[model samples]
Target: MRNLLMKVNYDGTCYDGFQTQPKGNTIQDRLEQAILHLTGETTKITASGRTDAGVHAYGQPFNFTTSSQIPLERWCLALNARLPQDIVVTEAREVPLSFHSRRGAKRKTYRYTINGNRFPDPFQRRWQHHHPVQLDIPAMQQGLTHLIGTHDFTSFASRRSTKTSHVRTIFEAHMEIDRSMCRPSSTDQGVIYTYVTGSGFLQHMVRIIMGTLIHVGEGKLQADEVAEILAACDRAAAGPTAMSQGLALMSVEYEESWE
Candidate 1:
């Protein structure tokens, strides 16, 4: 058998999540069903990470072992034919059998978008979180600076998460306004986007970080107080966890073992 890695992009607005479930549609179920249809064999695929409901992904990676002789290009075409319209396999290639997508990943980048305007756009409502209040960008940036290093992110994670350790390294974290990316609406205010790239993220870590920064932006939390929250390691000290629809897993990086 040969192992193949596939890069998938999906709009998570319609599905439950990435993982397969017995009741609802999922990215994993659809991909596996498509593979079974094409190759006539049930293939168990593993993904780089699990995205929550309503969260999208651009370069999510997954690997499956298959004995079929179909070309790599056919994996996309054949799967796209059977898969739902919301999910698509963008690329596929042969990989080492031992190369597990999640275990081999070195880093991941996620972006959270906020519509910082008085009026929300109907078209972009499903993709962005609308925040009517004017945010103080400098204060938000100050809070982001404190998040640039390694720390125990217990305050930024969900209480239900089963992870043993909350300590994770954040290589970079920043927020920026993308004027050009904002959809035309009643208000011309630019949209604020938080881009976070880290070694790995705890459950709901990015959403909680966005919530804390939003509080800082609204002047509810002091920028300098972020360090205190990190030191406290109390989940209740952080702001509310933001919605999942505004978050997207942009990419996952791995070493060039195949190259």
Candidate 2:
């Protein structure tokens, strides 16, 4: 059995999500079908994590076992040839049979984009969450500091998660504006990104965290209030769930230490 690991990047605008569904229009379904077409092999692909519907991915890793003799370098090209334009296999490599995409993951970094501008950009409407008012950046940054260490992120995850442990170590968390430009008549604001890296995240964790930070920015909650929210372990105490389109699985890390 030849084990292959792939780096996948997708727009995630039109599909249900990364996981396979009965309807067969997801990222996994498209990848599997493309692989089958390229190598005539049927195999299951496992991702580092599942992004919610309309959530994008930059360097999501997935693995599968195949007996096909395709060259590793050509796998990306071959798979992309059969897949939709929105989904692309960025890189492919041979890995040990012992490696599992999800199991081998040490940490994952997520990025959530917010359009903090007065006017919405039609071109970026599907890629970011548009907020029409100026946000209190300092308040949101103060809130992010509370999440940098280990804690039970119960308040941030979906209540539907039945996991035995809600505790995850957050290696880093921060929010910053990517870029800002002033024009003669208008401003060209790029976007604000909330970045979080952790050992693992429960379902909807990052999105909920973003929501809470947005609330902090809006002055609805203070920065220190995040600590209380985590301690409460009550999902209802958290802020609203942010839009899925603003969230992206930026990358999966397998290094021993992210610190």
lDDT of each: 0.89, 0.87
Which lDDT tens digits does candidate 2 get at residues 1-259?
8889889899999989989988757999999999889988887899988888999999899999999988788899888899999998888888888888898899899999998766777888888999866678888999889888889989998989999999999999887786653244555454898889899999999999989998998999999999899889999989999999999998898754211
Q: How good is model 1 by TM-score? A: 0.94
Kindly provide the TM-score of model 2 when superposed on the true structure, using C-alpha atoms. Answer: 0.94
Clashing pairs in 1: none
TM-score, one value per model = 0.94, 0.94
Once superposed on the true structure, which residue ranges of model 2 sit more than 4 Å away at CA? 181-190, 256-259
RMSD of 1: 2.0
Tens digits of per-residue lDDT for model 1 on 1-259? Answer: 9999999999999889999878978889889899999999998899999988899999799998989999887788889999888898998999878889999988899999998877777888887999978889899999989988889999999999899999999998888786874456546557888899998999899999998998999999999888898889999999999999999999899987432
lDDT of 2 at 242: 94
**How many pairs collide in each candidate, listed in order?**
0, 0
Q: Which pairs of residues have clashing backbones in candidate 2?
A: none
